[model samples]
Target: MSDRTPNPPSSQSRRLYQMTRGALIILPLSIAVVPWGILAGSLAVEAGLFDFQAQAVSALVFAGSVQLVGMGLIKAGATLSTLLLTTLFLTSRHLLYSATMRTRISHLPLHQRLLLGFLLTDELFAVSSHQTRKEFDFWYAFGAGFSFYLVWQLASLSGIVLGQSIPDLDQYGLDFAVAATFIAIVLPSVKKLSVLVTVIIALLLSVLFSVQGIEGGIILSSLIAMTIGYAISIVRKEPL
Candidate 1:
């Protein structure tokens, strides 16, 4: 018997492996979003939206933070323009996410890219971006993103079912899962000094903005931190 190295996996097998790995690797983060999804649905119901309306928001918006904040603005009787602007501000981060993956995904067909854009979320961006750094795989990214979307839909449905029966579900602090999940995703990627500084600044600004009762503070802080981080990188790259 000859002892020989095994042949490399076929392209088809490699795609299947990455897709399966993507789905499985994203399970923990997908689970982490369950509570956030539930909260979004419950909050929508609590804000005087019909059950179908809540479900529609979850289905169409597909963004937990935007849905939650939009519901709050609705409850507060915000103007239509205010609602639209707030939503745009909250979801603008997705533009950055898309830009980060543009080089990798540019070759995909328009329909597939649209599907990916629709499925993209904070958690999916975190997981898929991490995976992309190791090896680029469209099937893997699609699998991870689609799985998370399914879990989110089911979780939101459960919330809608319970929203009427359980009063003040939001007061239970289940929303903490959102922050915890983001922390888990972020801490692992803060390898450089610039990244660490960005994280710290974002955290501090978030808390300060919250205490000051500023709307959209979280997104504002994120934008500021990212800008500063980019500047730091540029400066580091320049010759003294």
Candidate 2:
């Protein structure tokens, strides 16, 4: 064995420590996310999945909205091709996320960036992107991602285990949890009037589409709203 002593945390380690601390700070913010997980579990069970299978989706996929969409498609007897297409449309926003994050974590190795990309959810990205501290590093992202991942999985499992007992989610307003979580994630990102306007427009479009009984109403609304938002931002020359 080599006789070299292990060095204390270097600059990279210090940065990781800051990132971890940041993760700790934001972990509790995920309380708003639990209900969505619960809904996913319930939907999974309702779609003929066993509790373990439902729980596995939570632990593996961990995207609440996508889970719901997938379940709906499964219920409709969608083919694998259709399901993959739908999932791609729903998750296309990650392409934008990857582009933006490239600048933020550029100093990290490619493998680390890839790992972080897997954990990049709306909530974690929203919080971490605003971090200006140089010390904030991969650990911070990891902490946030890992915590959210674990809690989401557990909450989903709980829902799966108890979905049979809980017959009326609408009565409990649990279905709204997904919306609430999205709102919570979004509110912090609004820093200007342009952003606020975009959000309002998105909401209006979403409501209109939902009222019209559009399939994939939320996704449709998001795309319309984002398109409108992008147009307004471009017209105004707003710096994103």
Candidate 3:
């Protein structure tokens, strides 16, 4: 036998490394999300919701925009049917995320696929879909997703508990954190002119929607932009 020794890390060392790296990576990312959670929590309190109820919604629904819209509707005294319809419209983007992910994650068992689908939020999808390692596995994605979910719920709960004690966030420019994080995550994926055009169109539409007082501006803008982008691709005979 050859005299070479294996260089594998010990189990304890690997666990420590994963935990440390996960914390380091996740903490900053979690900070970026804190503002949105704070806004959600503040709004929940303003809507006459209890802390527990707000926390429950954050934990269960787990979609930021949808949660915000739902809270808004509740505050407006919207009927159940209106609330349900608004939520469906707001969350319809998940269908696209699910369809795209199915091709990548289809080899997994039914239960695993179902669980993954439930955990698939915008941030989780952004991180997991772009993983390039040959050894990357569903467990890694799951770990990231679970960690994010926990952090988000905790942040929202803290915000609810500490609502108003937090100073004027708008004056402090906290809202930019989410957009900055999104840009950081998405910039790497723009490999073609078509993709660039799609992003630009989406941003423009988002601005226009905001100007026009459209509710759920980002979602509406993204849907319109994606549709237009696909149409442009078809006209130009470009592959998606």
Candidate 4:
């Protein structure tokens, strides 16, 4: 036998490895989020927010969909109460994300849990959920989330600065990049029949409700889709 024994990786090195792995795994989606972040910042500026205020919204709110909707509401002269209620409704989806992740993160300390909650974006959720429980690590999640956060901040700043110069930035349809990226990410994981069926039905329902001009139609469709998906999974005795 050889006399030399290999040294184990140090804690710091291990943490760095996990963090780097997470960030790399999330890089594609993070890149997709850049245009969405820029759109949010530009919309904020167009809605009459100062550059600093627009950046503040991005840094503080950090929810792309909500920030977009909130800016639309602001442009429409929505009341404060209406904006607040809409924000609450839009963000309610995070509750589901939290519940789904609770089992994985329950053992973490309070501060870590809080930080995780704060950093939990839809993209991060999708990335983390794809990992098996055995592969999940807090540092991994943090690396992914923090990197996305930094990207969003920089993207938003770019938009704020450039928005003033661009005559019609929204006309370029930048949001399509965000949608396309999410579709690519989600499609790979829809290997299960139940998931496939649920996604189809959800798409149909969302389109039908939106076409009908139903209030909160997208949210309603999501709730119904989740319920149906759960029932189908139970009936089929398959994991979802």
Among these predictions, the greatest TM-score belongs to 4
Ten contiguous residues with the weakest lDDT in model 4: 1-10
TM-score of each: 0.77, 0.70, 0.76, 0.81
lDDT of each: 0.81, 0.74, 0.74, 0.84
Candidate 4 wrongly placed segments (more than 4 Å):
1-9, 165-192, 210-218, 238-240
Worst 10 residues of 1 by lDDT: 1-10
Candidate 4 positional error at 192, Å: 4.5
lDDT of 2 by residue, 42-141 (tens): 8899889887788888877778778989988887889999999988877877676666677777778888776677778876776676655453467778
Model 1, span 1-240: residue lDDT tens? 132236655666766877788788778777777877888888889989999999999899999888988999999999999999988888888888888888777778998888888988877787777555436667888888888888888988888988855345466565566567667778998877778889988989989999999977867898899888778878777322
User: Ranking by lDDT, best first?
Assistant: 4, 1, 3, 2
Q: How does residue 181 of candidate 4 score in lDDT? A: 62
The global Cα lDDT (0 to 1) of model 4 is 0.84
Candidate 3: tens digits of C-alpha lDDT, residues 77-107: 9999999998888888788777767767888
Candidate 4 structure quality by residue, lDDT tens digits, 31-81: 777777778888899999999999999999999889999999999999999
Clashes of each: 0, 1, 0, 0
Better of 1 and 3 by lDDT: 1
lDDT of 1: 0.81
**Candidate 3 deviant stretches above 4 angstroms:** 1-27, 131-136, 163-167, 231-240
The candidate that wins on lDDT is 4
